[model samples]
Target: MGPARVAGRRVGQFPDGSESASIYMNSGTCYDLMKNPTKAIEVYNEGISKYPTVSLLYFNKAITLFNSGNVEEAMTTTESAIRYNPYHASSHNILALSTANSNKVYSLLAGLYFLAAEPLGKRASGRLKVVEELIGSNVKKDGEKKVNISMPAGDKIANKPNDFSSVELMMSMSAALSYSDSYKDETNIEQMKRNLGSIFGVLSETTAAKGGKKAGDKKAGFGWEFYAPFFADLQKKDFLDTYCHIIYASSEDDANTQWIKDNSCLKKLTTLLK
Candidate 1:
């Protein structure tokens, strides 16, 4: 029988009930580190069979799948991980990266969620870039016009009721508007605040109209359930400026850095969440 199939073989190895799941996660990681992605997947699957609700197992599996270039499957598995443990920051990180190309809305939400949970470190720096890219993905500077707008095409971004299509379009428009003469003179911090404010404003409106049902309500998915609601609430409460600064805490901009020091908004944000 497979090592994972040996039920209760190493029970109580740790004081807590996490030992069995940890073993499987570690075993899978070893395989992944050895460049045996197929075997790593098998091990992760076996672990998942026994611990279907263990987010770590699902997270490890998703990592292997993502590294092996199975992005769709990786995204699916990462969603499972988030479903089981919404607070798993790394799962949100991978989900953002996996879906960034296929679905900008999901990518932006996941990336934001990850940054909220882990707003420091190398992982956060990279995630911040992804979030910025998602925000700026649909705008351009064409000749003397100085601002050109574009929207992602295809059935994936079609305008379905209760879907992120509107939010996506609004985000693109926000990006284009940021370059308009009215906004062109603002600092990057102000520009970002405006852009994200527009995006989150639409998100709040859509999520509220949907009665805040679970994710997958319409074309929305885990992002709607886990990340959107919180951000929507933040927008509603007018705390989006605090949030933007928190995620961009590493910015070297004098205004950004000064804002972080001048305000207790970061502490207030954490308190509000709790």
Candidate 2:
């Protein structure tokens, strides 16, 4: 059975189940997993309204909001959840993801730095640079106390952080810059290669130290597979071709020969090129 139905069954067995916020939160989770975010939000909202003091309910609602693409609302809801319960890990994780997806890249990176720094410190630099370059400002000044990066946009648009999708975008941009023939201008190519080499070198060393394969080394042996679709969609032919070569070279997969035939994304990309 689904999460909501299971939660409902569990609640039905309890004498005070009708008044339990956790049951509602669980129901919402089931709905979310079913891709019914609106229903999930409604259920979470009801739970919060019924049990105003239940911090977890607020967290659930905030996550629902985020999944529904109402990131700013999600941010506020998460703050309320934290205010009610400071020790909520899911709340922190959701907040991190929400913030990362909301275009508040700088703030999100800072939060990630604080949350994952101990275990992830060595690899954080490249991710941190992604935030700085995308946001055009450093939260950490050379000789000043670290400051909260402010979003000049109104709160509605500024509160959320960059999400996993944003990270994928960064990877795509990096791949494009690394392989684009536009950089074939002798001077430009050399500079682009150097920058890409440095970035990938750092990433490789860091992942290696952690005993993980380098970034983008998936089982399919396609580096930046997720990012490849974006570059293809954008009609970045040179980058696309180079990316395909890299993946095929790395994997020696004959399937790579029929990449456009195999991947719907690449097929759409071919249309874009035409």
Candidate 3:
């Protein structure tokens, strides 16, 4: 979906000003899902202003900031989200992802290993592996087994320095590191490397074992992280044309704005955001 359609769909006319919060919040979600983080941020700010106590507004804003690579602002916004709703799962998840990318090892580990363990990290590991396989790696040898590697103790690895010349190698290594069972250890750089290599080895084995092809190995498919490109592809293939027609017919309106307002998806999303 394009930004204009998304914006129009979610910003339906509400009779009461009190409903403006709902409208803005829903608009923010549509913008975020469409990969327009700046628009999402703006709508979320408007939502928060209309309903100061709505924790989901802040949480969604934080997510948009994080996805936009505004780590500092995202962190601050996450703190506010937690302050408003301490038990919000999506807030914690976004905070965790942001912390992981920012090199906040302790907090990131806590988020991934403890708070968001069951729902986030394990699923993320699977997704990471899928991406690795798509990038032409075999993943069968890894087989979900935890690998142990011995290494010297230090803040940095002095023993087997990385050769960062190859972008493909670096990307593969980064993806592999996400599946390492002990990524939480700040002092185990060598162990991290070894575990990553193990993952790589597993990918190689899986590829060879399968005689060179695996299911869904064509391209990077749809996921939350790459929603924009996916949405663009859908538009290119005229999928949105059918969707818009259905939405319009159901609501008796040419615009999807009214249909989205009557739908309950955004309500569920609000709970998730909180």
Candidate 4:
């Protein structure tokens, strides 16, 4: 029989609480694996109704929504998961991927949060690639002699302050600068450090300008309240280098591995995130 049937058969044997929540989550996952997203969402929602605070239920539902191509709903459900448990790494992972095209900075913020919690895993490896793409997405090379820089125009369209336009422009500029003569000799890791550091610095400054406010206007939400502060603090604490290495650790890059071995900041970062 299917996992849902198995779970149904054993339902009354276990008490209602976290363990029961896990059964729901597992049954929902079984449905998902069986290519039944509708049934999966039904099971997850039932679990959420019973254990309102279980973040995994929301996370599993978000995954189903995303894989089924209901991206907007997936984003909304992931936000709910984050609301219940801010440190849910898989929730952050889905959020990062969902927002990568629509919101660059928010994707990076969530990507970093996910990596911080789940470094040195298959998930981290995939997220690191996506984060690197976001950091470099704006810069395109036409030839050895020509480069194109693309910047998002959302802030211009909205005509608003405290938006991500500055960071987007900064990212474009930094990526363009990577092709400059002065930076041409730098290794891929070095370029990543500089470009990623530039992005983080701008976000940190934005956070400071907001004067510790939990949210900006329409553009800011969970990213402002949670991710912005976390990464901003990392930038401020001079842990950006350490962080870059940590997120890239799954790549097994010699430099990143060596840096992690030489530095004491990983423990400190873990503590801060906790």
What lDDT, from 0 to 1, does candidate 2 have?
A: 0.48
Q: List the residue pairs that clash in candidate 4.
A: none
* lDDT by candidate, in order shown: 0.77, 0.48, 0.45, 0.77
Clash totals, every prediction: 0, 9, 3, 0
- Model 3, position 161: C-alpha lDDT score: 19
What local lDDT score does residue 141 receive in model 1, on the 0 to 100 scale?
Answer: 87
Q: What would the TM-scores of all predictions be?
A: 0.84, 0.41, 0.40, 0.84
lDDT of 3 by residue, 129-216 (tens): 3322433231222455653222223333111111111223333445455555655453222333333343333323322112333212
Give the clashing residue pairs of candidate 3, or none. 138-203, 138-207, 139-203
**Roughly what TM-score does model 1 have, to 2 decimal places?**
0.84
lDDT of 4 at 224: 66
The digit string of per-residue lDDT tens for model 4 on 1-274 reads 8777787556445655446788888888888998989988988987898899988899999999999999878987998899899877889989988877677877887887898888887888888888778878888999887989877666432333234666677877898988789999987667877987787777766532233433332345666666766766777877777777777779978876888888865786677687
What is the C-alpha lDDT profile of model 2 across 221-240, one tens digit per residue?
12122222333233233343
Q: Give the residue spans of candidate 1 off by over 4 A.
A: 1-19, 157-163, 207-219
Segments in model 3 whose C-alpha atoms lie over 4 Å from true places: 1-16, 101-106, 109-121, 124-274
* lDDT of model 4 at position 240: 72
Residue pairs in candidate 2 whose N, alpha carbon or C atoms collide under 3 angstroms:
99-161, 99-162, 100-161, 100-162, 100-163, 101-161, 101-162, 101-163, 102-161
